[model samples]
Target chain A: MAHLTPTPVIEPLQDRTMILNMGPQHPSTHGVLRVILEIDGENVVRIMPDIGYLHTGIEKTCEAKFYQQVVPLTDRIDYLCPLTNNLCYALAVEKLLGMEIPPKAQWLRVLLNELTRINSHLVWLGTHALDIGAMTVFLYCFREREDILRIFEMVSGQRMMTSYFRIGGIALEPPLGFFEKVRDFADRFPSRVDEYENLLTGNPIWLMRTKGIARITAEDAIALGATGPTLRGSGVDLDLRRDMPYSGYENFKFKVPLGKEGDVFDRYMCRVAELRESLAIVKQALEGMPEGPIKANMPKVVLPDREKMKTEMEALIYHFKIITEGFSVPAGEVYQAVESPRGEMGYYVVSDGTAKPYRVHMRAACLANLQTLPLMCEGRLIADVVAAIGSIDIVLGEIDR
Target chain B: MALAPPITDLEKLKTHPALASLLDWNPGAIEGVKFDRDEMSIVIDRAHIRDACTLLRDHREFAFEFLSDVTCVDWYPSEPRFEVIYHLLSISKKERVRLKVRLDGSSPVVESITAVWPAANYFEREVFDLFGIRFSGHPYLRRIMMPEDWNGNPLRKDYPVEGYR
Candidate 1:
């Protein structure tokens, strides 16, 4: 039973060095991440991140709930990009059912997904800068984030936990002037990016803190399962939206931003460039927006419209059955990965031909990305550890779940 | 569009890149092959999963250099009660493949792929933590999501959803 008690993450190498514990509560470590660091003076000798403080067992919970009921659970995994989680879960389930999403639903998914990217990145940019001691950028980033939250509220009715996406399609059609509100934000966002860039891009203090600090090579990043800006910052050109092209992303045009140096600054720059590319994709989705039904035609799988349910007897019965018993999915497994703002967010769903899912495992990007922490920060100064953690952009809810 | 039937016959899927390479290396290594819903899954012999992963990663034609995810599915009251699934992605080719290894409930142990891809470190640890499956040669095999002192594996089918109250 010696192994029953967890081994200490690090052992002291020398008498000169001492161990230091940082945050399951510290603001800099992001959620409930506890880092055990063995340091000699200012230099870091070893770094190990201890997690599981936020564990709620969402996957175990999914096994008991109906397939449709799991969408809301997905939202709690990554609070920053709830819609992206919704989309990934929906796509995986839809693939399990072999359902064909309407063109309009696909396009709408693309539009909202990019907006969610911007929303997540804005929070990361603001908080990452704030972690590095730039307070004003936090305020500026949140200002635009407020607008994005308004857009999410407009679409999903809920601000943060937006389970707007359903297994067959979206929850409802966009309200009147929804496009107009998105268009207004899209039109005014570039200048706002410039505003933040003016504040920190060329700032000497920012550059001194981030450039050449917490660097990791492309090969090492890939080996450690790093994705999104963390891998892109190391010069790996892989974006799931462009490479795999799910949810009608092949129709849109955008560039996958790459960084030459695998450093905190490079990751920051990559995410900023991505903000522009995501906006470009959003504009494309709006310009060539498809006109048709917002959900698949499968009455058994998708919920019927309120008007149809009221008028048609079959629709009413189907609705009642779906609400009570839930639709049984085909017995199969499907892995659906999407290019979430932080990285490759994937859902590996296995169905047993029952109303509930057999196993719903979320391939959380943060959990993998967080593995690269020791690789980037082990030999660096203790202060640069903060830069490394911020650069990875981990959400503990996703990591623990 | 109606769903097409899954192709589970090993003979029909012999030409698939992943299966072809595995067959070329050692036909006995693969226990089964399935292509369903536009995704390819190959069941590998539990003893040779690590070697098969190394071969696929080093194979030039199908370079699955990145290990995307590793998970386990538990089927209780069955002989082969655990299915350890590994999702591999080729960054250059933009292709994906799944490898599964089945284990019996008596001793649910399999070789770790951390040597092939260090990324498997956390994923393997997570699977070990949740499903009570053992990954031989894993650097650290401790509970991840649950506490170290917690009793029994919670994700197993026999475990109550509400926990042992």
Candidate 2:
């Protein structure tokens, strides 16, 4: 009998880099993201980002509930820009139901969405700057941002994750002086952005950490499924609002800022420019405000008029049915993408002619943006890793969802 | 930044022969697939999955070039204990297609697509972390999003929410 001897192949470990385990708990990892980085002394050899520490199983939970009940759940996805998630989910369901929102509702959504973009960008700039060792920038960014959060509260009764965007239109009419407050903040925002740029743009230290750090080409950006400012930072203008033109974004005229260098600085500049652009969009939406009903005329899908709910029997029934049983969307699958501050926030919804979504999937931009961390962090200094992580602008809620 | 490609046309392409055959191919055969206007599937066979994906992705008529995401769903005692889903997008056509693979309760193994798209690497690790579904041929198969010493897949339905001992 020939002895079956299994020879263990001793492979020579050549010039391979040493493996360095980075945080699932470290504060700068941005929400339980553990990156296993291969390092060659000071330089990162390869970075592999590990996600899902904050996975909430929200998608599966959505399947168990009625359609209307899912609105509040969406507010938790990105946490920073909750209304954008609400709008995207509603748009997906609305497409299936074939309901067209009224003009006023559309304009309101555009206004709120622009405000949400600004709010989200402010948080990004604040935390991103702080991550890069600029603590003052974080505080100053939030100072101006507090005003925007107040506006969100005035409109939706919540500071963040305002489930203000509903299936057809808004949850309700705004509180008093919502426009005046928005205009006031918009007026003050231009100078604030200049302040941010001044603090970081000219400072040699800021430039050193950002200018040449984590440079990605436009080709690699698209190949890696990069979008929003991350892709735009590479000099490719791919704003879904302008190209895809959702929520009547085509009606407005605004500039899509592009960057040639495609570095952390470029991404920062892209987002800062977007802050001004978001202000411009908000101002344009207010100026071009169309006067009409806030909700669509489709009582079948949309809730009945509030006043009619008091007297009309049909209206009362619809109001009761919509909230209780939830409106039945036509059986279909539609993927709706919105230009969220982070990137392309898409909701792929499948309806089986029921009140509940057969399958609810979110193609979160933060999740995709976080994917390129390895490509960016590899070959960079250990200290620059934090700056690179901040540059990607990831939210774990979006990634884990 | 410049604008991304828009307007996906997949509804028409869902009518393709291989997938079209799937249109009426006994919707009940698959568990997670639900039909209203057409078959909206949440589960597919491990064998013909690559074919179904190619049918949706490679076909120029329904080109979904971008692999947006890969997520795992744990449904305990549902015969198929786990469901792995892949979300794809076609920038040129501007359409979205979903491919799902079912894993029975026993041994969960799904073929790795890292060779196809590099994006699947991290996502595959995530599925491994939460659901414990091993991806064969994955360059480095280890627990991602969790410590290596983690006892059980946290997202598995059978794995108690507190963690299996």
Candidate 3:
């Protein structure tokens, strides 16, 4: 509605600069992100991203729902990595409740989280390459992504919106042959990465399009609150999985890829390398899989299995009470930050020792990373904006949430 | 691990880096301190939050260079109705500390931290848009998620979950 007024979001500084409006619908933006660009001929003078087109007010909605009911809503925040959102929210609530997740559940969470990362990066690689005019990478990427989706569906019964991660632990025990399917996919995912790299990593056209385009310095990236591959691409060398380990990420061994140039290609290379590293973590999780209950033993907080609920009265009563009246959490706050595919996805949960959360705020990495767009795209060619947007890998759903 | 009780006493928490630095700089600036759930939260006096933030960011021992997030919590029907939460991270040290500034229900206003870390721009705008809390000296304080012509701040407890319509 603000844009409807006669004055622009950013006024032109010089006479030569003319205002140009990019998509709330343009394909390169990846979502309903309306960027108002002040251009001088083909060069961008200033850029301000106009968002909130996808705002669903999920945070306000979370206050009204029971704690467990909020997991399904987290899935909609960032569709690319729904489980990552699920994990972040679940961990935050669990921290508030001070519940101990079993070893098997932690390992399973790590294994599936890495798979979600690969799944997210594949879609990013495919779509990013396509945005850069490389068509084959998109096709090759979705091929592997389909396998990951199938793995998700096998475990959660839903492919995209898998609200699989519960507050105390996971929703259900991972089904039979889930590990085999994941292991089989993991065995072949590296070659698939090679296939993607061979297509774009060596292509001169791809290099010309991405390298040295929309370059940002390390200081600027950190100052602007950039995280994930965007910050790693700027050579920050900070990964929450390693620096601040959670969900048993401390047990996994993997390398954090870094980039010196902070260009589109460097960010591109960082994510691609992360694919291999994520696969390595997945393999490790598979080899050292733990054996125990998927859900926590706290029946007051966790739902009982169907068989137990039917056989035992106490179990059924606990399930009914948990369903009807949610378990209360301690009156305090905890901010849980996880290294998601995009960046540091944080969930700040505050409780009033009640069944419903008093406040639930998501510190979306994209919202902060989006601030760096002006720094990256200003003074660069207009087309470089596309490359820059792709480099950041923004999901407007997360940005506007 | 069993859940340990939170340490709310200022004397016990003054040894922490953030609280220690703030106490060293100006003891009057800190109103309260909390070490809960493995996180440290310092409730700073509203008048001195900006200076406290500057000190915390530049201090040699605890260089919390990264402003991880800025959000607000509304304790409706209470005198101090809003608590503006700032989560700061020391990237080099791998540590985090939360800074809170409470504002009365009559006038919910606090100094903007955008001057310290430019990353606070959008976050502050979102807070202003959702909770109607004003951040003084914010460059362009506009409604970010809601329409500019929207009626009320939807996040406050007084606002109905559904809508006026």
Error of 3 at A280 (Å): 0.4
Which candidate wins on DockQ?
Answer: 3
Q: lDDT by residue for model 3 over A1-401, one digit each (tens)? A: 56455233577889989888898889999999989999999999889998888988999999999999999999999999999999999999999888999999999889889999999999999999888899999999999999999999999999999999998889888889988898899888778888898899999999999989988899988888999999999899999999999999999999999999999999999999999999999999999998888888888999999999889999999999999999998899999999999999999999999999999999999999999999999999988999999999999999998
| Order of quality (lDDT) | 1, 3, 2
Candidates' TM-scores?
Answer: 0.98, 0.81, 0.98
Q: Report lDDT (Cα) of residue B135, candidate 2.
A: 89
Among incorrect, acceptable, medium and high, the docking class of model 1 is medium
Question: After superposing candidate 1, which stretches have Cα over 4 Å from the reference?
Answer: A1-10
**Candidate 2 docking classification:** incorrect
Q: Pick the candidate with the highest lDDT.
A: 1
- Report, for every candidate in turn, its global Cα lDDT versus the true structure: 0.93, 0.77, 0.92
DockQ of each: 0.63, 0.16, 0.67
**Compared to the true structure, candidate 1 yields what TM-score?**
0.98
lDDT of 3 by residue, B1-165 (tens): 678999999987778888888988999888888899899999999999999989988999779999899999999998799999999999999999999999998999898988989999999999999999999989999988887778999999899889667
Between candidates 1 and 2, the TM-score winner: 1
Worst 10 residues of 2 chain A by lDDT: A1-10
lDDT of 1 by residue, A255-285 (tens): 9999989999999999999999999999999
Per residue, candidate 2 scores C-alpha lDDT tens digits across B1-165 of 111222234453455443454555444433344333232344567865555555555665556666777776665667777778887766665544567898887989988877666667777877787678998889887765555665777666555534445
